[model samples]
Target chain A: MPELRVDGVTKRFDKVLAVDNASFTASPGRILGLLGPNGAGKTTTIRMIAYITVPDTGQVLFGDKQVGPWSQKQMGYLPEERGLYRKMKVGEQLTYFGELKGLSHSEAVKRVKHWLDRFDASDWYGRKTNELSKGMQQKVQFVTAVLHDPELLILDEPFVGLDPINAEVLQDVIMELKEAGRTILFASHRMEQVEQLCDDICLISQGKIVVNGELREIKKSFGRNTILLDFEGPDGFLDDLESRQLVRINVRSKSHAEIRLLNDTRPRVVLDEALRHTHEISRFELVEPSMREIFVTAVTAQQGAEAIEV
Target chain B: MTNNIFIVAKYEFLKRVKTKWFVITTLLGPMALIAFIAIIGYVSISSLTSDDKTVAVLDATGILFDGLNDEDGQITFVVSNMPEDSVRKAVIRGVFDGYLLLDDQIISGSGEATYFSKDGGGASFFSRKLRNLVRSTVEERRLLEQHVPPEVFEILNARVDVNMVKLSDTGETTGGTEAFAVVGFIMGFLIYIAMFVYGTVVMQGVMQEKINRVVEIIVSSVRPFDLLMGKVLGIGAMGLLQMTFWAILIMAGVLLSGTVVAAFLDPATLNLPASASQDELLAAADFTIPSIEPAVFIWFVAFFLLGYLLYASLFSAIGSSVEQQQDAQSLMLPVMLPIILSIVFLQPLIEAPNSTLAIVLSMIPFTSPISMVVRFAITDIPFWEVSLSFLILVGSFIGSIWVASRIYRVGILMYGKKASFADLIRWARLS
Candidate 1:
């Protein structure tokens, strides 16, 4: 599979700059997580890469060729707004979508049947799309994206509105596709899923990319400054630490907390203080910043910089 | 790229063609129209013959009743010796439908006769029949008094029949003017209806895709222009198919009815005057089927295709611009106005196909689809004018598709706000 590259693309809608000088690339046999807050230009950038809309400036290329109708033939796209022809049967609708992507009739049909059987939804082949549940429709939608077996697959918010079981099923298929050397670019608000599945990540805020690198390296840059605390105690030591400006509590519950050290404070110092408050320390570990924390910190910092500039 | 267009077209075409509604409308629509016409004809004919009327005549001038027949099938005329007062009384007593009173002054041809009935209307069929009988009898008596021959008088009073034949530019006589008008009106009306029905179908189809957001995925796979063309061509083909089916059924119906009429009616039994020649006799007795020129049908199809393409593109543009059906009404008014105006012009254009109003309307592309076909059917339009109208229609279609596709490319992905004409114009100008 060829690599997908978006080189310095910009898009403007009327007075709004929907996407600004966005650049990124996803290699074959890897998943690129496009992370952003609401209205952060993720969908716009994805749309340009999917060849659904043209960029106002720059270009998107597949291998050495510019993204166009020809490039679109080898691209699979599942848009943010999911839909199927409500009156059309699932099998026929998928077949139509497959053929639209340049598959022969028999090949499209064979793949549609294969995907339907793989998802345990073969019984829904003859049923109208509207007759199926939302999750069922979602399975069929996923099949459409992969039925033509394009080299690159772009899924925007694919797991949205899916039950955990269905989401897991979809995640496993995505893994299998990645294993088969196909490129996958997906955008989602579920930070944990991105943290688990993405090999590389791009974070956009206010129509600008604030961070783009391998997920592990990006997390490593934040350093192992966060401490995970798991203990059965009153948890009063956390408040004491926060009030004294020794640590910032990223997460807290009755018996668990993720604390970020402030002002270059040592994890040993915080752990010694916690031991004094309670003798029962079930778990304590120093770990790098999570993708969720990295996303929030990066987007907030970008917005703060923009605020100051404005 | 063209392959994707065909794929989309095939999908759209099959999607609708397989619907139950398509089957019902294609098969039953013409049958319903035929049934409706049959009912109207039967009602009018039955109403005319159902009423039997009798009138009593009190001929104050005795010679008025000399040669007058008593019964003429529909109305019975009784030559009564009763006085005028008794005749009026009998009419009121329901003995007659009316009473016709004649006097001596009728012989001098300045007399006035009065027919009294329960309705007391001069326009009644019975009264008109009685008046004609009395006047003819009086005139004959006066002519006899002058020693004029009865044969000459009969010839003088005979009704003349005029056969209207349209002379084309080539000096060849074609069908009758009435037949041309009927065919023209039917053709114009059908095209007018098709423009609205199929144009709205295209609009609704686009709106459905936009609302469903299926367009987003489809556009990713194909150019927006290709998708738009595919849909327009697909639905247009379906409309053409339905029309062709209707045309065949109508032709079969005409042939069947002609056979039935021929089997039922014998030429020898038809009432004819002794002086009638064999040719005139046969012409009257035979039901001459008016032959519509093939060019009329060909032009009908050409105009329909051009007109549908022009309007369908505009409709699809409007469809993509709005999020809901009600939001489309404001935009629809402008597109609908030209089609409505075309229909309004149909009557006048058919009435005077050679008039300047007809000529000008038929030349304009917006109104030409219906108007030009009607004018061609009613008269022998100059070949240059026909070709010019067709060229203009094709040109406008191309222009509209270009503009509409631009708007559609931007509009289909846009949501949240109801788009206005200004927005559409801006979108059209967008790269």
Candidate 2:
């Protein structure tokens, strides 16, 4: 199993700092989600790791060795910008890519057929890439990226433009790869998928990393301050607690409300206060914050800190 | 690395060779050349060997045809003492291809005579010959009437012969400057056209890959320089292949034409004109075409390949930088300017192959591909000059590849924005 590490990497395009001191690690048999907003330098970091571009400072290492051209052969990169020879047949195009990745001619042909069949796209082998739908093209792109079975896979926004069914299929394939002990690093803004798929995460904002660690540990670090309440009868009790400085209601409806307890606030006191006003408290429990809440808060907090510095 | 280059080259060659346009171009060259030569040969042969045409000469004066002999092989005069209206009718009815209505007024200067024929534009070849015969007979009769000897007219009409010979530095002489000019112009023009055609093929090949967005994947697999060189060499080989086909076809066409002409011109069996000696006739009918020297042809191919490489690298760079076909037009002008300038100056080079301007242009990399060929064709160039030109061209070709690979490395991944010359220069500097 391979453990990949990117340490203190910084890249600049002209005067703009595209990636600043970015660092993350993906261990063997695990998936790492690289999260960011648009132009957050996630692609740049991935590119540097793939050896498509050289970082101005720092290094990317696979196992104990520095990443180089040989490392590129051992890795698969599906860049954000997708490209294929539209005039070439799917089988031919995939075979060419496989050969470029150092597969022998016969081996590439065999792999192309096997993968096409796996995806139930055997009939599309003879068709040109442009003749297929976008989703179909994306499937072929995925096949091209993973046909060589690289040890370290870096995919940028891989699940974009996919329907629920295809997205699930890709999610299943990615998990299968992880189970096979491949170290995968994927970048996307879709939190639900990332929360479901990733064992670890490195979140970046405005060309800087805001949070980096295991998914569960990062949520635990934020503390269990969220309270979900299912109540019947009077909803006015929720409005009464809104004036309390220690609690903030993030969402509220007729029978349900999700509340955030401020720093050092106890769950018992909040429960007692909620039951005293509501006719009945059907359910009340303190829970960890959702990934979406963490992401938005972390990014916003980082932005606010930088704004104050200016 | 070299193996990858070869693989890419083989792919490019095989793909283009299989295209229908290549097949059509290869076949069309020989077909069109043969058709052109056949048309010229047919027209000249038909005009020379046409049957005699008979003309009704309505000599109203009755004396115009008195001593005119009908021995001229091309025309026979038919005397008809008829009305002019009927003579015109006879011409229209096809009884005569034409009629000469010579009248008594024609002996005087006050009236005009008319020739009637279906062709109103001008006299036919046969009719012209008849007119010349009448004019000569009338002139002889007038000379005799003036007590002038008819033999004096013969002396006045004798043709003058001017023989031209070219003397080389070794005192070796050749007869025709005209043949040398034709060959030089043709060879120079051929390489000029070839440079543009094959150069643009490379440009468009690069542009196609760039437009399809496949170059980044290819470049990652192999160095951009390797890809550029592979494409250049591949298309260059194709150009050479097509030229080889043309050379073979043209040689066959020329040899067949020569054989046909030789059969018709068997001096021992054919009748000779009364005044022409065998040697003189053969010299006048010289059909031995001048050929390119084997060494010169070898150099031509070398220069052609080098020239294509030099221009194609820049073309590839330009192709990679542009986002679309229309975005390329303004950038193409600078790349094309030198080739166009060379063609514009080709006339002076051909006229004076050893001139200082020609010599200078022939040694410069940009214009050498064309000017040097013109120099090689019209005159024997010094060995040192040819070698120097070769060195310069080869040097520039390598330098272009280095610069082009730099731009190509950066430009292929860039999308949406149209790259200007400044951007290319910036990329070149960065790389």
Candidate 3:
């Protein structure tokens, strides 16, 4: 059975429908990326699955049971807005959060120490929470969410406040949990991180999912294999070139005019045209349409393509 | 449920005890209490020395200076030989606490005298004492004119030795016992108020977390009931620890202060030179104050535990719905106001334990914990009322947990908004 599932979930905040007909599933050993810009339905959907709020009309299932029937102790959720008792000690705060997750004193202590060691924060065991740096506090929060070794983890903006090194550490921990066959669902606005970490992706925009599918399929259907060619001549020498499939013209200068192909119209043509124009070809290579471009195009131009029809 | 409660209580105690805020406050409270007592002790002690009080005497009558005092703790005889114009001037220059003036005419039907001092100093005890001295001196001359012997006059002085006797057809003495009982009542009341205040704060803390979306991460693996029990027990324990430590410190401070006070009182040994005989001192060794009364100890432990749990449950529920500190303030007043009102009216309840207000507030679940403590302080309460209150408080304590959990179950997930008291009422009414 899938460890977690949400089906046709619709949630409204007053007159505004925050999550409209949202649906997803995560079996064990999988990572699902809940991707969206601010004001998107990702948080609303995640909150429903976490049982913090119920959907107006729909079902959330954990294992084969409806989320309503499942015990509250069976899940772990780290909300987007971070909070910890500023005056509480680090160990004490974790224990309180850990014990809230159903770990006993001994169990919570062991787990806290283990996570503290993993984050290289054992030195801060006796320190108060507010005394710690932002990155350290984030690690404590992450530890709290998984303290019980939850079967399914719902993390809203998990990478928030994390430095690059710590972000990678979090990714490694998520993967390790995934290797141990736990389901992970995390929300992120960072497109590359989602592309790298998540097996399945749900991209939302304006309280609606613009795209939802396997990560590989979504990348495949973006339909733009473009290359940036940075070569130079007189400025308008490349601008006046006859490449009918020019997707975008990024930078055109006296020494350089970077050009991109619209589709799989071949970087060779862009290079060939550039070669005929100038000997100052500094760099030219094929580049896939980035996830950021896909996201921007998907969110901004919903009326045109509407999430590639799936 | 029992297991869940233990788990929560254990975690709550552990979490609170380990907090630097808790540790510092726990230690800081006793220290503050000690320091406060010490400062008051020092001020009172320092005030008692070979202190001099200067008195300005504008003796216009020429012979009134014979009855006035010399330089002692008594007023110094500052015979202002200067003209009457500089008398008020001398006072204005801060020469004395106040000045006494004699009327130009003596032994008239009405002898009018003027007193001069700063605004706050006018009604002072020293000024009053001086005025009394002048009146008595004038009265003594009148008594001498009536040919009354001074020694015989002493026999007719205002004095009494009426024995306190209680009679209900038969007479029996119950001297000063009511005064001692009043002391017990005050002690009982102080403990209850202190516990209720701090314990309610604990409940508020729990509720704020639920309302603020801080508890969602906490409650996933932890049961709601455990969280509730944990906070109550943890805070209740902290209160007890604080009281116990402060009590010990106060005991030590009292003994230390008592010795110092005794030595300080030795020099200023109270006396009246005009009296036939000095009033006898009640032997200090004959009296005893309890080191720790078992009833007070039991009330402190039992009532504090029960009272705090009862009040805190409602606080926790109120906290669950309100998201911000400002909103909590308005809601908090309604809940706390009843407890405070009960405490304020405690003296009346002590005067008559079965008074209508006492009976009404003691029965009211919201006001009962504090009201019952006030009622319990004065006299032995009937088992039924005590049990009824305990029963009602325990039941409401449980019911409020249910109410809070309903709000907690729903409220913990809510963000960017507040839940109203009416919203909580609706939730409580929901199945």
Candidate 4:
């Protein structure tokens, strides 16, 4: 497997700058989660990487070779708006996609059978795509992406429209592919999935990269100021802490609350305050900010910066 | 990359060829056409023989009465001894379809005859038959009174027939003007129909890929231009296959009919004109099928391909630019106009294949495919003109493909917005 690199790529659509000097790298045997809010140029950046569209400036490379027809064969892209020929049989459609990626006819057929069996969809081989349920069609589409056994797999919003069971099944396969030494670039709005599956993260806001690094290092840089409180009592301490400017309440319920320390307030002070108000403290722990919180904070901060610059 | 183009083409071709619609159309289309022509022939022949009309001739010139009566014809002529008033009364009473009154002054060749019927319209149908009988009878009577020889009278009454033979640089061919017109019209019309049908097929195929949203996945693996070329070539191959099949069937039908007619008819008994040469008589006796020069077919195929490529690429571009079928209509009008105008010019071009309008139409790339083929069929076109027309068609197709592919690259990935003509131009201008 070869490493995939996108260096200083820029793209513009008419008057809009879709992506601005975007740069990122996905290493072999790891997952890189491309994170951004809606209309943050994630799809555009992914398209440039996938070679579906050329960037206005800069280049994308696989190992040492520039991304082009040759590199396209090595990269498997499952686009955000993915579909299969509705009137075509599952096996035939998969075989065609495989052939387009440079597989021999016999090899394509063999791999199509292997992938279909792996997905537990061997029974759908002879059925038209429209005859299958949406979930079933999705399984077939996933097979098209991996049938060629590409070195770099870019999946944009892969888990959308999937039930938990199917999503878990797909997640496991993605993990297996990573274990097999393939580089994966995953993009999604579902932050938890990225948090669980990605080794590296690149966050973009308004066509610009706001944060890019290893997920662990980025999370550590945000500081471990968030406290998860589990207790069985009135939650009046959360309001008191917030009003006192000691903490920012993120979430609150009758028996559980997530609180983030403000102004470098000590976790010990917050714990003592919680112990005084609650009858019983079952669990209280300091934790790093989640990917969702980091995403919102980074995006909002970037927007604020832009606002001030304007 | 070229390999990927073939792969895409194979998929598109096989997908359509495997459908039931393709099989049904390929097999049944020509059969339906044959059946339609047969029905038209049978209706016309039956109409001519089915009606029986009788007309009473009250001839004041008594010599005309004997020659006018003929019972074997569809319109039966009978000699009536009744007075003019009685004959008119009998015609009105439905005893005759009409009554013709000829006076003795007709012998001097200056007299006019009147025909009377309840409805005056039927006179035109049988007037020529009655007038010819009366004039010949009066001429024979005058000839006998002048003591002219009977053989000389026969020579004077002989009818002359003209046989049309087309002389060309290749030599003279015996097929008449009607054959030339028929072949030209058929070739031109077939090209016209094929451009529309196969071009629409290309458009629909592109629309299917876009609507299915499978184009993004396919384009990620191959160039958009390759996909466009693959689709057009694949569908065009199917069109060629079906057309070749139809041509074979038509040729076989012509040969079989010729054989059937030759087996049943004898040359000596046939009432051919005396002026017909031995070759014309033999050809008529054999009921020979008109031999179309192979060059006509070669040109037909050349023009069909060039014309199809030009139009299909434009159609595919239209397909990619719009998300919905209705949105394609405004874009379709400009492309469709030239094709429709070509058909509108077909009649006049056929009538005068060497006219300046025909020459201009054949030279223009948009109309050349149809116009040039028709002109080639009917007349001897200059070699330079044909070469120039072919070159222009090829050049236009290349230009169209370049523009269409550029628009298609940007349009296929675009969604949710209805693209207008201005947007298409902007896309074409994009890198």
Q: RMSD to native for every prediction?
A: 5.0, 6.8, 6.2, 5.0
Each model's DockQ?
0.71, 0.33, 0.34, 0.70
Interface RMSD in Å per candidate, to 1 decimal? Answer: 0.7, 2.2, 3.0, 0.7
Model 1, span B1-431: residue lDDT tens: 78988998899899999999899999898978878888988987765442677877778788676667735467677889977788888889998888777876877878767777888845655556666777677778889888998799879989896667778765655335776787787788778867888999999999999999999999989999999999999999899899899888877876676566655555566676666555555466544555778888888999989999999999999999998999999999989898899788877887788899998889888889989999998889877999999999999999999999999999999999989899999999999
Q: Candidate 2: where are CA atoms >4 Å away?
A: A225-286, A305-310, B29-190, B260-284
Candidate 3 residue lDDT tens string, A15-93: 7879888777777888888877777788778767776567888798887788741445566677788777776788877
Candidate ranking under TM-score, highest first, comes to 1, 4, 2, 3
Least accurate 10 contiguous residues by lDDT in model 3 chain B: B278-287
Each model's TM-score, in the order given? Answer: 0.85, 0.77, 0.76, 0.85
Candidate 4 per-residue lDDT, tens place, A1-310, comes to 6788889999999889989998888899999999888788998888887788999999988898888888788878898887899989999999999999999999999999998888888888999999999888888888888999999999988888889999999999999999999999999888888999999999988899999999999999999989998998777778888999999777678888888888999999988888888899988999999887788778879888442211
Q: What's candidate 2's DockQ score?
A: 0.33
Q: Please tell me which model should have the higher DockQ, number 1 or number 3.
A: 1
Task: Please give the range of 10 consecutive residues that has the lowest summed lDDT in model 2 chain B.
Answer: B167-176
Give the proportion of true interface contacts each model preserves, from 0 to 1.
0.89, 0.28, 0.46, 0.89
* Reference-based lDDT, each prediction: 0.86, 0.79, 0.68, 0.86
- Candidate 1 chain A: worst-modelled 10 consecutive residues by lDDT: A301-310
lDDT of 4 by residue, B361-416 (tens): 99889889989999998888887889899999999999999999999999999988
